[model samples]
Target: MKKALTFLGTMVLTLAIGVTIGQVSQADTPSAPGSADDPIVTKSYVDQKLAGVGSGGNTGGAPTGGSTTDASFKVVTLNPGQTLKGGEGAEFILRGGTATAIASTNGGVSDVTGADDLAQGANVELNHLLLTPRNDGRGLKVGSSTAYVLVRGSYTVQ
Candidate 1:
C-alpha cells in the first residue's frame, strides 16, 4: 500500500511539471509585431486641441480667460484601420467624418458585419450603465478618412 501511494504521488508531480513546461513553452513563443493588418491602436487626448480649442491654463502664472468651468475633456481617436472599445464603464460620443461603427451586444443587434455607416459631421453618443459589460458598445472603423473622433463623457470610476 505504501509503494502504491508513492507511485501515485510521483505521477502527480510528473504531471504537474509537464503542464508547467508546456505552458512556459507556449508563452515563450513570440507573437508577430503589430502592423496595419493587426488590430487598431487608438490614442487618447485629455484636451480638445485637435478641434482648435485654446489651451485652458495660465502660461505666465496668471489665470486667463475669466472663470472657466471645471469640465475635463477626454478624446479618443481611431486610426484608419484600427478599432477602439469604450471600456465597460465608459461613456463617449462617436463623431465621424467618414467611417463605420459596429455594435454587438445583447445577442447582436448590430454585429461587426452590420456596420452603422457615418457621413461627415455625424455623431452618436453611447451611454453605458456601470453594471454593463465593456463589450456592450460598438467597434468603430474609419472607412476612407484618417480617424474617427470620440468625445468622452463624464464617468466616475467605481
Candidate 2:
C-alpha cells in the first residue's frame, strides 16, 4: 500500500510541473496586434525593437560614434651610416630606399640591402627607436636620432 501511494504522489507532482511550464512559456510570448493567436517571434519584429533603443554612443549593442585622425605619408630618405629616430606614438613606412638597421621596440634589426631589407608598404609603430643603415651597404639607416632623416608616416593614434 505504501509503494502504491508513493507512485501516485510522484505522478501528480510531475503533471503539475508540466502544466506550470506550459503556462509560463505562453505568458512570456509577445502577442500580435489585434490578435491573440499570433506570437511575435519574427526577425523583423526583433530588429524593429532594437532600432529604437539608443543613439550617438551605443545603439542596439553597437558603438555609434568614434574619432579618427587624417591619413598622410611623408617621403624621406636615409643615407648610409645615417640614422633615423622616432619616439613613442610615431608611425612610419619605408616607402623608398633601403636600410641597414630598422631598430625599434617592435622590429629588432635588419642590416641588409634592397627593398626586401626595409619595412615597405606597411606601417611600423614605434615606442622608441634608433634606426641606422649598415656601413658596408649603400642604403640609409633609420632610427630614433636627430642626426638622421625622419621617415614619419601617417596613422590614427588610437
Candidate 3:
C-alpha cells in the first residue's frame, strides 16, 4: 500500500513538472521578427516604405532626390490651360499662380486646410492642403498664368 501511494504521488509530481516545463518552454520561445505576432520595424524603414506609397506613374515635374522614382513632394510648374490631375490620395498645395478645382463626377477635392470641399471650377486656395478623394480626374486646372504647385503622390500633366 505504501509503495503504491508513493508511486501515485511520484506520478502526480512528474505530471506537474512536465506541465510546468512545457509552459516554460513555450514562454521562452521567441516569435519570428517582423511577423504579425512580432511586428518589429525600424523608423527609417517605415518612413521609406510610407514615402513610396501611392507614388506611382508620372510626377508631372522633377521630383526631389533628382530621381523620377522618388516619392517626395515636388514643385510642378503648370502653364495656362494645363491640367494637373491627381491620383487617389494625392496631395497638392498651390504655391503660386491661380488655379481651379477639377472635381470628379462623384465628388471633389477635399480642402483639408480650409475644411471644405472644392466643387468643379472652384478656385483653389493657395497653400491649402488639397487631398484628392480618388483617381477619377480630381485635380487642378491652371488659370491664365503659370502655376507653381507642391505635389505629393501620383499625378499627371495634361
TM-score (all chains, Cα) for each model? 0.31, 0.26, 0.56
lDDT per residue as tens, model 1, 121-143: 23333331111135455445455
Candidate of highest TM-score: 3
lDDT of each: 0.46, 0.44, 0.91
lDDT: the better of candidates 1 and 2: 1
Per-candidate clash tally:
2, 14, 0
Ranking by TM-score: 3, 1, 2
Better of 1 and 3 by TM-score: 3
Q: For residues 1-158, what per-residue lDDT tens digits would candidate 3 score against the true structure?
A: 99999999999999999999999999999888988767798777899877776486445555456434445789999999999999878899999999999998989889999999999999998999999978899999999999999999899999
**TM-score, cand. 1 vs. native:** 0.31
Quote the RMSD, in angstroms, for model 2: 14.1
Please provide, for model 2 over 7-94, each residue's C-alpha lDDT reduced to its tens digit, 9 standing for 90 to 100. 9999999999999999999999887765646644766787887776653434444334574333343545554445444433333445
Worst 10-residue stretch by lDDT in candidate 1? 124-133
| Candidate 1: stretches off by over 4 Å | 1-71, 107-133, 153-158
